[model samples]
Target: MIPASDQDLEQVQAQFQALVMPHLDRLLGFASRRTRSVAEAEDAVQEACVRAWLGFAGLRDPAKVRPWLYCILRAVLADNCERDGRRQRLVSITRLEDEHEALVGGDDDAVLVEVEGRLTGEVIRAALADIPEDFATAVEMHDIDGFKYQEIADILGIPIGTVMSRISRGRRLLAGAVASNQRAWLRDDGKGERQAEARRAARAGGFDGGVTS
Candidate 1:
């Protein structure tokens, strides 16, 4: 790549700071969901930003910047996974038994009430952590970040069809994980309190679904 002029570099830097910084929280959340480690996610995003800055001159379309940056991030994450050789582990809601126990505080009803809000966040996080990185990234970009399908496609350097497939499959996997966990939690006679707590937690987590009966 040709070296960008100083002015051009400055412009690119400014653009990145303005357009990209606001999305750091969302991106970090995406990374955390995929990597299951907040530190790793932060590292991945920082590396992506560095790569973007270094490659800014090669970017021809300013309008495509968001997708382009995301693409860089995706690539960085893939490289990390490959280097680590960590198999993507499927997270099961049933696996949250220990956490659930901790939240529930040992009493049937009180445990349910105590755990309601905390369980939702933990369950959501675990559910998200279980998906494959590619699918998870797509879901994070399209569903969580609210990027359009076309934009997500561009960001990941994949076709829109692939984006749709990843999102569909990822959601299915996440839903299954959540359902499995919820079922396990409800197996006790204290389900009423648990559901009530789940609803309150969902609201606190900013989930529109609120609570389910």
Candidate 2:
């Protein structure tokens, strides 16, 4: 595409900031759940942002901005996955330790709470990564991002029934993965202790939907 005029560039940037910037965290979360690494997720979101800025003029309906951005993000992810030989890479949970540390920014107890929450998120993300791409995307968009079925279908360019099917299957697989992981942890004394501690911390903070004792 030709470079935008100075005036056009300014207008596009303004619209993008207004419509797309607000969804950056959600986009990053969505990408993170799909990607193997934080760097890859960030790359996908960055590419999507640039594409959105360039194509901002074509997006006339403000109401469709969120899905439009998602479309761009999805495409970027697909391209990256294809180029990487379709390998579903696992994220290193250790990296999350740093994020948890930054998030807690407090004494020991607060640090423990953040670690529990971070591990819960990591477990889910890892499970999602192991599922089929379509199924994982359906589950993440509908369940994690809180999009309606019809909205998911539209974003994915599939029928609503297919979206529902993918989500149901994906959720089943996710639950099995979580349960299996918890059982494995329980089998080992050291890991089991860590798992119990994390759950206790999560409970103290009133967090829900993690490995239950």
Clash pairs, model 2 backbone:
none
Candidate 1 TM-score, C-alpha based: 0.62
Shift in Å, residue 207, candidate 1: 30
Q: What TM-score would each prediction reach against the true structure?
A: 0.62, 0.65
Per-residue lDDT of candidate 2, residues 68-88 (tens digit): 999999899788767765544
Candidate 1 residue-wise lDDT, 2-53, digit = tens: 5579778778678878877876776676666556346778999999889988
Tell me the spans in candidate 2 whose CA falls farther than 4 Å from its real position. 1-9, 88-120, 184-213
